[model samples]
Target chain A: MKVFLKLALFYGIINVFIEESLFNYPEYFPKTKYDFSKNNLSKTKIELGRMLFYDPILSIDSTISCESCHSPYNAFSHTDHRLSHGINDKIGKRNAPPLFNLAWKSSFMRDGAVNHLDMQSLVPITDSLEMGNSLDNLLYKLKKNQKYITMFYEAFGDSTINLDRVLKSISQFELTLISKNSKYDRFRLGEDHFSDQEIRGYELFKKNCSNCHKEPMFTNYKFENNFLDINQVLLDSGRFSITKNSDDFMSFEVPSLRNLSYTYPYMHDGRFSNLFEVLKHYSGPKFNSVSLTEKETIDIISFLLTLNDKEFILNPENKFPVNKLLK
Target chain B: MSNKFEKFAATCGFFFKYFISFLFIFFTYNLFPQENIEFQATFNNEATKLNKNYSIRKYHFNIKKLKFYVSNISYYNRKNDEIFTDEKVYLVDLNNPKSLKIKSQINKKSQLYSFDLGLDSVINVSGSLGGALDPIEGMYWAWQSGYINFKIEWESNMCSNDNNQFIFHLGGYKKPYYNKRTVLVKKRHIHRLIFNLNKFLKKINCDRQMIMSPSLKGENISNLIVKSFEFKK
Candidate 1:
């Protein structure tokens, strides 16, 4: 009986490893661009990352966590806020973009500044207007926490918490945030059917928006000049700030059209409060390349909403660990 | 348990002392007089360092920030065939004078070649990395997907805009605009590599000071910065 139990345990471990290796996407979805070979995923690492994501110990004063701005209820994007608020009610310059299906993103942020998801966590941690904490100090705090010490040991053998492990673990949790079960996804797989309006909208989307916002991922991952008149108070030049080239002036990363309903107020600055305003803005003279009628606008918005994955947001795996580590 | 830990710590302390002595002997394994390969990024001369007024391009200037990356520096044997050790990339923040001096390791008799100066395109796209390539260094572009191989910023009376600040953020990792550069020093066999910021600043026009992307103009600026490195006598 003891030998049988040991064999069962070994098989269980193997099953967990196999599940971690899977990208959790449909066959139609392209191969994930994330180089997971560097920081391979495991249940322990993902759990540790989830705890870190929810824990406020990463902040200078331990007042805010990654979940503060990126709440899971709103598709991992905070709702009803244009600009993100960090520690001490400090207002950030741009809106917090939704975090999901990150395995496909080659670059991150509205400005397309950060390339890899692993290093992406550092921006908010060190930003003076954001978390306002240093990496060295944050590591010291993590080392002090006994629970974190055990978690680190479990995830990355021997409990040494450095930049590589911290970033990689967080990435492991983030990579699991794959969203492939939307109404649109089911429609594509022939498991379900789209409404007539949604089908019409999809057609319009292919004709107009697909040039920039490509399929499957709904983004080409390139910076383009959207020609949004610069905000006077918070003057953001988009990608030009990073590149400083005049040609790249007023350019921003083409955001994914997925989960649009949950990720509103729209645009980089969160200017439009709703999809109607966004459609109206695009219909205006700013984007003269394509014009949409009132019915077409509604139809496209209807199709965009079909991309929302309720399962991705409400998944038990992605939620706060209230019953597990926190308790 | 407390009593046991205290006894264990005492034994550890005894071993630590012997470990230090052993390390001293291990480091001095070289029979001949040992030499160190040290590199320093210099500004002006010995009398002048950062935050102090200096003259370059025939104008008064004081650096507010100066950070750049040097990577894959390898030491070659006398035949220049075999490599001693691949030099890990290091970000030299010249503003803090202490960060200027970098001590390197090489085989005793081997002569060193020019260090691979900046991050290559491969290193930029390789996702998250550690040590000097760590994202916390502030050399990586905050928004874009590439590493900023070199960053030089200063305030000068010569500049007219940006509060008289001259800024150069040079990096890119893609076709046509590839930004990572390698500086090869073929001639001098020296123990020190000196980077004189004065030489770089001498060529800069205050009116055209700002460059944040990798372009033809940015490439010229980076090439000039690479030219600033000199081996000490």
Candidate 2:
């Protein structure tokens, strides 16, 4: 009986290790930029991160959370609102970009201000308009919570909670947000086929948008000027604000085109509510080369719809921890 | 013969005393092998204490805080050959007296020493770090990721704002605004690295009292910081 119990315990440990290494992505996806060696994926850590992502306790007044803006059903992006609403109903300057395929991203934020995914949560947590909590205060509150202390001990080896553990655990959950089961992915794998309109749209996309919004992952991960007219109210200069370089004026990160059906309104400011409106802006007088006919615009929209992954959006694993959080 | 014997005995006694003293020093040094590199912040050759009032050439100010990072400290020989390098980053703050002194295992044979005033690009981009490089230290910038190389805040009448405050946070890991400056001291025997702010304060442009981000001004101020270091034997 003693020998059997020891064997079972050893098997459980092996299972945990296997689960940590099981981060599945498509074969066509490029090598991830995130250094997984620093913060290895673990079941406990990912679960802890999911809870933290959904928890409003990260805020000063415990009123706002990451989920408040990034809803799981909407491909982890806020919908309808032109700008992100934070704590105290204070609106932010830029749109809340959807959270997916973060492992491949070299930088975070629309302005490319954050250098690493592990460090990205610090911004929203500390921003006055957003969570509005200082690091010291946040740590203090987490320390006081017995549930967090127990969860932290399970995730890490010890119960001692610090800024690094909190940030890294959140990153582990985000890294798992890979949208690789789209209709486009299936078509690439020869499991599905695209309609004639989608094929024509694919050709048009190859001709025009593929340079910045590349294939496989659907983004080249470069900051480019999309020539959107500056909002007189916001007067926001995108990447220029971070680098302080004149040439980088009004340039924002080229967002991944995956899960577009779930993630809208479009653009950095969420100015366009639909795909046709986004295409209209691209086909405007400023972008003469991208002048698409009305028929061509409709075809492109049809093709973009194929990129949406319902499997990813509705995945039970990606949703809030109902059992854990509620309990 | 007796007089000659007395002379020989006296000579042996003289050499024995010298030998005993040498043995004592060698063992004590080995017991305490850790060498220290002490950083001192001074205003006009006097130690600059936190929240202390300082006046120089019509500028009256009280230093609320002064903290900076010193990283990749290395020792060199007379021929400029690298001897030993301490691959640790230290947060030297005026408020923390113990943090200002960094201990290293450097030999006395080293003729020169050098260290970067800020963290290298590699560390700046590398995810979350603990200890001295921890974000909780208030040295790490959250909105835009990167460590603040040098931070100095003063309550001064020179500022035109409602609150009489002048602040400078200087750091940038990416080019062409990379602000980490290498400071080399030719004398390695002098462990005291003094930051004399007498010249730095006088050169401050009072009109632009606040500089919190990376820019041309941050780069220029970083250069001045490299020049501000004075060695005390």
Cα TM-score per model? 0.77, 0.90
Q: Candidate 2, after superposition: displacement of residue A23 in Å?
A: 0.7
Give me the candidate number with maximum DockQ.
2
Q: CA RMSD for every model?
A: 6.8, 9.0
For residues B1-233, could you state the per-residue lDDT of candidate 2 as single tens digits?
99999999999999999999999989877854567889998887899998888887676779998999999888898899997888988999999999888997675678888988999999999989888888899998898999999999988776565768888899999888898989988887788999888877767776667788888988888888778888887
Weakest ten-residue segment in model 1 chain A by summed lDDT: A15-24
Question: lDDT per residue, candidate 2, A153-266, as tens digits?
Answer: 999989999999999999989989988999999999999999999999999999999999999888999999999878789998999999878888999999999988878888
Model 2 bad stretches (over 4 Å): A1-21, B1-32, B159-163
Please give, for residues A8-76, the per-residue lDDT of candidate 1 as tens digits: 999878866776575578888888789876877788999998998888888898887899889898888
To one decimal, what is the Cα RMSD in angstroms of model 1 from the true structure? 6.8
Cα lDDT of model 1 by residue, B125-215, tens digit: 7777887787667677644567888887778887655468778888877756777777765543576667777776777775577787667
